[model samples]
Target: MNVKTEVKQIGLYINGKYVPSSSHRTFEVKNPATQGVIALVSEATEEDVNQACLAAREAFENGPWRTMSVAERCEKLRRMAEIILERKEEIAGLDAIDVGKPYHSTVQHEVPRAAHNIHFFADFVQMQGGETYPMEENFVNYTRYEPVGVAALITPWNVPFMLTTWKLGPCLAAGNTAVIKPAEMTPLSVSLLGEIAKEAGIPDGVVNVVHGLGSVVGTALTEHPAVDLVSFTGSTATGKRIMKNGADTLKKVSFELGGKAANIIFEDADLDKAIPGSIHAAFMNSGQVCLAGSRILVQRSIFAEFLERFTKAAMELKVGDPQNIDTKMGPLVSEQHYQKVTSYLEIAKEEKAKLICGGKRPELPEYLQKGYYLEPTVYVQENPKSRICQEEIFGPVVTLIPFDTEEEAIQIANDTEYGLNGVVWTENLQRAHRMSHSVRAGTIWVNCWFVRDLRAPFGGFKKSGVGREGGHHSLEFFTEAKNICIALK
Candidate 1:
């Protein structure tokens, strides 16, 4: 455990307490930023997962959380949000250590937003809707939003704390109990969330955590008969599998999965505005974000110039220790992922894409040892259909492809199977609006890139996976509808 002060060990959380998993098996969480092991986490088995699920089910069926009124529940969530705000630094520090998230960004961007998200959902739920019926039946009719009991939340390692809040907030707000299965790689920060919830007076077993591999804990949670809903964030392939297993009981399932987003930059775009935003979109979090604007679509007129600007901007990004506030980027999560990314470099080379900047691992920086690191890379390709153009590298890499017309830009943007998000960069308000409608992605960003507001619904259209997270639209993910009828005579 004697490594960087930035990496630390983590324990599992269950029934309002932190403890090791019954199954002593463990996994290492690698910091993508440093490509180093940040924490060693306990791996939960099927039995352990069942224990967590049963705890959540019991809480939902008979515990204080389920018994609480909407107003009471909202109060609890607000209290939890307050507790999070009070302990923001400690939790933010945990995120930087456990996941190698940039501390400055984690503090200013992720942590506050997470706390606000819980509060926002709490406020949103206070206005829970039930429609008054104009029924012709022998009974009066209405509909109330009811929580899907025993929610199984399987969150990814990338944005562990924030995604945990996203899954936890509306779930509790909707009166459901949750068994959260944090990815083995990034389990501790979420465990800390469990701690904060406990301190904020979440009743025992209201929220439980079992840290482990997806195949073990994740499958168990999805397949458990007692679990009523499964919310997952990961690959599209894994989301499909979760849906299949949850279908055994026909449980309600929501997925926020993979993305190969297209970021369209037109000739009319203000390159001054678009270049910086595009660089951030393509390279933020080292481009590991599911909605990272990975595919850069530029009009033929501006393609060369945009490439130059984008390449310079990407190179300008400083990748180092995420704990450093001045560091703009970091390593990929692990050597495995870094290798996967490097392989993509080979593929890009075979496809005849020009490497405008980095495509290989950087020599050891003076400040770090024992972490996987890759230099930021930019690829310029003549063919939009190149393999590098379509595949998701999920690294600090950018592909610059040229498009001839607005129609072709839309076509290229919509060409991918993954459509989580896309950006249309044009000063012309009309063109921005047009392609926003035309793109097949779940979220369409016009002019601005990666400015993800909490109110906007986020998800993908085709292969980006099913269901939406965030926005007023998120309530549907945690709720099921029921109609009550009575005669209006």
Candidate 2:
């Protein structure tokens, strides 16, 4: 199944078409589950990025796409969704190879949801428009939710298919053109999306994909003066850099950055739900996710019991190849990530935290030796200031800290500088709502963890980065208001 035999096995997608990079340089897409070269993708240089940017600008300002009405755009977007559903296999296979998600999840979840995302945005594009305000004077007053010229969308590799749709859906729905760069580590899935967009009858220059090192293409996308807005999803450190870069152009920026989400387990939480939900929150996506519940805050009354049940669940997760439908845990994204995660394990020991269960490699198939495998790990830290408790330990690792009072637990949860998300586990409704509000994160879950509705806003406060994504926030990112008035007799 050398699907790479297809036209863009690895190439830049610009003007609604795939083409080889002007810079002969290219990079290998690795299979995180196997650590093999999945495919060779074209690596765009700074110049190539400018080319994409120019095309997006031309499209936004003067091309046929710019003049297209909301009804026209929706028709094309809906057609793209239909094409995506028809090409779901190709898209799913690309995602699996590019990022090592399980085949079943790729085909069943990522591809289908992405198509619906396109359709979802298409459904609303026609309905969303500018507003008119009534004024006492004789002047006509109106406002438009107009496009913000060229948009630069940079997505991470963790959930490439899902988040690309998250960013692109609203950008397109609001009539903005884009130059999108999926993370270098997992560009294929979104590249496959490029093909679907072309097949869907979208005119050239509306959407462009440039796959390359972020240092080169990413820098160009964020800082390009032609880019009117930037939408990014990644670490806080990088988000800061992008923000600084966008400032040079005084460009609008929307970021979905880092998280060290707090997962609280109170004395009265139902152990059955709390136990499994905590494990799913911390270890889903092998804990490579940004919004993972990596910091576990437990009430002193149930700390020991929660740790016991939580560690038990962590140890039982099936650590094996992603291709296996039965495997609950897959490899981390890459060797770099694998090393980063393992080093944190050593950090826990040096910091003198109590290692609960599975902390090292799993003795699985010999082939996994070449992959980025990590067993689930949980630790009990003495305090909230522990380095592991504060940092984004982006792996199957979590630090559990105990607090006596509800007030203390809330304080501990809000202790981190990264207030991206949090989880509140309690049986009492009033207590759950209070605790959720008390936590400083942007989005809080009560009696649940890691669930999302696209219609809701998603982002963070403080160092977690600025602005928001999903729902109306996304459309707003792609729009800017302009006021015009004239004196009349």
Candidate 3:
């Protein structure tokens, strides 16, 4: 818990330089692993957001970025990826301390994945080409893709580095200038992105980072008329607000929103694989992931035994300081989020749900006593229609439900308004395919979980989100298509 880390003051990256907020106000960035303030970051006001938007618009309209050849744009992104990889350790440490993510997960998965995201888009930009078709004997038709001008990328807190590049990579690869507003809760790692872009030799105003609370800066960024597109990753409720605000300009909006995925484990499943995969789906990132399979649906025959094994695994999860490489679960992102999760525990109790394991905060190491920690909570829902069964807790809490038939399992899984991610654990390949098809979700995992290919389209089906992002899907979203018709003489 006493791991040494470098601390420095943080500021907004406007145009091509790091600067203070116009209002000169700042907020503390705390280490959730120890509840210590590690740095102070400038809090952008409405004015600051406007300035960033103006800069993005200017860059898109008048700067070399938009006019740059596709190969040139891709080269810059590739260079940024190299810079990001060079600072992998530092960024991983920052993510671990900034968002209370386990050190190993950050170091092994998030940081490297972010760098790969940049490079992936770079490759996409290089490989993708325009289309040409012969319409009639005397006419020719062709289609070309162009950048969507200024794009606003509003990313969330849980996985800052990964999500930052999720939006940034495609935005840059498509030759669009951008203004990024990282969630105020976890801003350290993304605040450094501007520096990396500058080092990568990206033209000025191509990428900008503004920091502030969502209510102030987020609203301003989405509502700005000059912004041609808004790509936001956050809660469903907030995504709705962004949609409404962006309606004035009819700006193109892309959202990757909330998810309450149902992890169904059938009686025919390989318990060894199913058990750990389901538990991991629910508990990864301390259950803070939007794709966390928080709802567990078990075949009635194996309900009791599965619950017992799942409870034991949940209890054994190492809950403590994120700085400890051995820790399996770290603290929640903030005191507010901790309270929200705990409040749901009380709600489960009131609704007469069974608390099989972990309903209270774990005793932390002496140095981390003040950290916002919570035990991995498992609940058995008596009523399938209960709020605890339907709502997104966004913490290390999962609800178990028993299903008698495959039809019932599919019904329960698709009952929620969210259709983000789902899992079906079964040895029977036919059943796996059926359940995966039956469940209405964007991503389906069969006998596995969280396995991503980066090339496939990723997005939610219903209230979860709008549009897809991954590989060429992302590149397409960041760009606009124009068809040209020519007559041959």
Candidate 4:
């Protein structure tokens, strides 16, 4: 595949216009699959982030967006969904090239999911209603939900576009204005949302996107007094920093952070389904997912057989050009991330864990030789407390551990500090139910992986995250509730 070295210019979108940064500073965004410059994006200064926050604040407080009828608001959101689908291919391609995700996966799954997120939230806000309480004859009290003012949405590089929409949908649906700071590495697709919002007839300043580094832009946004609340998705350490930044202003903070999820297969499990499902759980998006099951636990009865089949399946995955439809995996999002992931191979060896299948870059065409490509890696570690088993590698890596009993499996799964997501595979109905409840993570999957319902509350426990989003949980986080009382004459 021929890689494009042409650099497209991208700018900050504030107050309904695309403009260069106040300082006119720019940064290069590289294609991880080719190590070539894909775009030169405007780097937001603290002043630029302040401008975006002020614009969002003004919009939420004085614009017609909040005063618009519910029907009109929903219609505009629905239109945003429509435009997202209409331009799905273009958007998907940008993400594929910028984030090094497979084009097919981005188009087929992430793009549609982004559209669905907007559509679902648009409809959900309409059906949502306040609660009423009847006092003793003389008076009645009722609760009304009002939108929180300005929101600062800080999204991660992995699955950038989809996650941005995931936050944008609820924030806008509830009448809040936004200042989004997408991850600097994959800003291409998300920068297009400013135009999408404008074309959908959303009012000016209601949606603002600033492209820049986290230290400057992200810090300013989180600490900005004009920003009412922050919804962030990224590393746990960053989440804590945002919390501290918001402390002075007492900003409401919701975070979806790191994870080292566990996927357990019991002796009674069907290997046919478990093997492939486990593969998808661990290696999806090259294992950059927050919910990636990096820890795989198999019962002693089937450990050897499961490892053999799983290793072969993982080894067969095609890792190359993101543009290729048959490519199952792509490079890490950037050279820095590639280095971070590869460092774990050394950590695994130092921990005395045995490498079961892969840990090296694969042989590819000369065109892709410079790409940050690594084979799907599997390891066997007897110590559940090993760094390879406990920490998140955030790459195409999985550590296999064998357990003799269901009780031991649960113990091994719950040993991690992360409680984001987990999986249990078993034929015994009783055992499945027991394991699901025993796992400490949020959103445990029984005989499945990544099946999500928009209505369910989605967030992590422990170090994974702080609050929940999705369905009414999103509404709760994005809005403030007030009780109104009336006296009867």
Who wins the lDDT comparison?
4
RMSD of each: 2.2, 2.1, 1.3, 1.1
Ranking by TM-score: 4, 3, 2, 1
Residues 364-458, model 1: lDDT tens digits: 56655666677889888878788888877888887888889888888888777888888888888887778888888888888786666667787
Which residue runs does candidate 3 get wrong by more than 4 Å? 1-7
lDDT string, candidate 2, 1-489, tens digits: 234433346789988788889977778877777677767888898888999999999988988776788888889899988888888878877776667666676778878888888888888667666666656686666777777899898999988987898888888888888899999998987887666777778878888999988888888889898998888899988888888888877998888888899888889999899889988899887898888998888988888788788888888899887767777878888888888888888888889999888788888787768887888988899878988998887889998998898998888888889999889888899998788778888899888876778778888988887888777777777777766564444
lDDT of 4 by residue, 1-489 (tens): 333557999999999999999999999998888888899999999999999999998998999998898789999999999999999988998998998989888888999999999999999999988888888878989998889999999999999999999999999999999999999999999999999999999999999999988889999999999999999999999999999999999999899999999899888899999999999998988999999988999888888999999999999999889999899999888788889999999999899999988899999899788889999999999999998898889999999999999899989999888999999999999988898889998899999999999999999999999999999999999999999999985
**lDDT score of residue 386 within candidate 2:** 81
Off by over 4 Å in 2: 1-8, 484-489
Q: What TM-score does each of the candidates earn? A: 0.95, 0.95, 0.98, 0.99
* Least accurate 10 contiguous residues by lDDT in model 2: 1-10
Shift of residue 315 alpha carbon in model 1, Å: 1.4
lDDT, residue 447, candidate 4: 92
Error of 3 at 345 (Å): 0.8
Give the C-alpha lDDT of model 1: 0.80
Q: lDDT (0-100) at residue 318 of candidate 4? A: 90
Q: Candidate 4 clash total?
A: 0
